[model samples]
Target: MTDSMSDTLNNEIIVPTMAQMAAEGKQPDILFWVGCAGSFDERAQKITRDICKILQHVGISFAVLGTEESCTGDPAKRAGNEFLFQMQAMANIQVLDGYNIKKIVTGCPHCFNTIANEYPGLGGNYEVVHHSQLIQQLINEGNLKAEGGESFKGRRITFHDPCYLGRGNNVYEAPRAALEVLDADLVEMKRCKSNGLCCGAGGAQMFKEPEPGKKDINMERMNDVLEANAQVVASGCPFCMTMLSDGVKHTEKEQEIQVLDIAEITVRANGL
Candidate 1:
């Protein structure tokens, strides 16, 4: 059967999610999949590249399939455009099948959740992990080390948990773990984890303009960070990074505060 036809057929079959698929078998080795959010943002792309570099230094053999990358259809799916999401999902599955991708690592939380949790329904399944988790593993194995620099000692930082990564996928620890690895003094926001506020950029809000609300989602998150007197705000998802960065800028707090991805901070901690 033609590849497209095969994908269409696969989509019709219900399959276990990627996490379930991972649990069902020995892990596969070879591919690192970057979803649209990571691929589209310069900083996020850098983080993914840096992660691969770190893994390469530790003798992990893998390849990045950026050109083969596509949106996880998360936005469409979350926005209630199931048909478009399915089409996108099928297309991505076709690419993965072509590469025979057995394992995937992603930086974006939304992409991670969608590819790991939702793709099974469309018959695409693979072992997927957030970059933070992988980095933590590397650190534990003595494969990755942080060459401490001027400590962020006095600079208080707060973490804004991305909805998809934290609540949607229950990946609250990895990012926090990564920050802790940096020896960062982290102050938790009153609203964190499942109760964390949205950055207003999820569910494809990044692609479309945000609707009017009592306050901008990003602004709400920024206020929480500012209230903590944090000099830096760290997040796992690129959309969150971008939105929160914009939030700081919009609030005229750019000079007083900064937004960074966990990976970026990790690289810095290691004096990369």
Candidate 2:
């Protein structure tokens, strides 16, 4: 982690995506980091808590760095606010160091990307895993099992990939794996994975009004779900869930469809 790396962490310089952030490493055992999106959104917060609850049920003891949690500077970096991104990154690094936390799990794809991929430039490096990945591991280890009785019984559904998680981070399968564990009828959108469309809420779009475009990014994605005839649209990222839910509202598709996070869907499946 050099200053140049730190400087370029959010400098919009070409670099590896979030999927390549962890090559091999040792990590701390306690802290699970939740980014601003997870903290700020009630639905995301519920998902985070649900993850923690599931992990705890499996005998994993972890602490949430709530007050110490700050923006990962991802939005700022994406919006060309380099100074703010740098400052926020530094503050996050300092907070992590204060807790001697060397590992983190995040529910937000943007946070996971910044902390895992970009933080090394600022000399802040840690083993970061997305919550879905961790949950998958737990299920594989038999620590957590999906309650297959009546919770997961539902109509057909499709998943919308968040840019940071699906394209930016290359994490297409983990959330799907979690869904599969719950016996979800996973239907793929025509445009999925790295090719998935934006949710109209990334790159700081959540903070400001959306720019004019032929079609709303989120609406375009919702139309894909509608085309699939999916009754439920599932997503992992909060931003994606929010934007897509909005899209459903904007398109007046809520009557015909429902939006849910992977965690929420899983929790329902588990009868929790």
Candidate 3:
């Protein structure tokens, strides 16, 4: 969108708490699940804030888990530790069940995949959606309007699909719908959709060194972005954001291209 999609929120943000809603004997329309990255990673935190800004702008009743939230164990499970994954999932399930949460939305695809697919068998079952999907729904229902050409009017942007959200879950349209509202020239990589390339950050590879390949997965993936001649790289997952940002830097194209989350782009387009 703009030169700085990660611009700080100048407006006072009002994010409700599940506990506070509970005290009032009420429930939120959706639970904003700030996954581990959204809660702790500096860059990912901005996506979290932007998603909140959009939710607030659209007047949606959403609340965060706050202190009651824990890791979804996506990383742990992907690292091949089923026992640890189960333990972490069970702990989060307990907290979610305690709150009686019904619907969930998160900025991380890792958490989205884990909660929506993996958590069900462990006694955690809730309607979970990625922030991009939620934003698309909002836009479709006329809850979010970004029709005015704010920024990213005709910029060449390419979407980098995360494995968890795409191949793992088969969610390919929601993120694109959110981008369509920006009026940007959405380009496609040679390897996209079902054939999309991984950003090299999935399956907990982000927490460990690579396996001595000729080139890092992210670098290879970045090549596709470069080939598309995109001005901005749109990503829907926080993990993809980190890896793609690194790839842009590694290619020394940080000034020429930008890596932004879908929520960040949506907020910037809507002037949130």
Q: Which one is best on lDDT? A: 3
Model 1 Cα shift for residue 222 (angstroms): 1.3
lDDT of 2 by residue, 49-104 (tens): 66655544454545667565788999999999999999999998987876667778
TM-score of model number 1: 0.84
Model 2 ranges off by over 4 Å:
1-28, 148-150
* 3-103: candidate 1 lDDT, tens digit per residue: 32343234331222334334565333656666676676786777666565555445565566545567888899989999999999999988787656767
Worst 10-residue lDDT window, candidate 1 = 8-17
TM-score of predicted structure 2:
0.85
Cα lDDT of model 3 by residue, 1-272, tens digit:
12122322456577778898899998988999998889999999999998988877777778998888889888989899999999999999988999899999988888999999989988899999999899989989988878542588889998888898999999999999989878789999999988999998888898999998698999999889999999999999888898899999999998899999999899888778
TM-score of each: 0.84, 0.85, 0.94
| Displacement of the residue 26 alpha carbon in candidate 1, Å | 19
Select the stronger candidate by lDDT from 1 and 3. 3
Q: Would you list the C-alpha lDDT of every candidate in the order shown?
A: 0.74, 0.75, 0.88
TM-score winner between candidates 1 and 3: 3
Query: What local lDDT score does residue 84 receive in model 1, on the 0 to 100 scale?
Result: 93
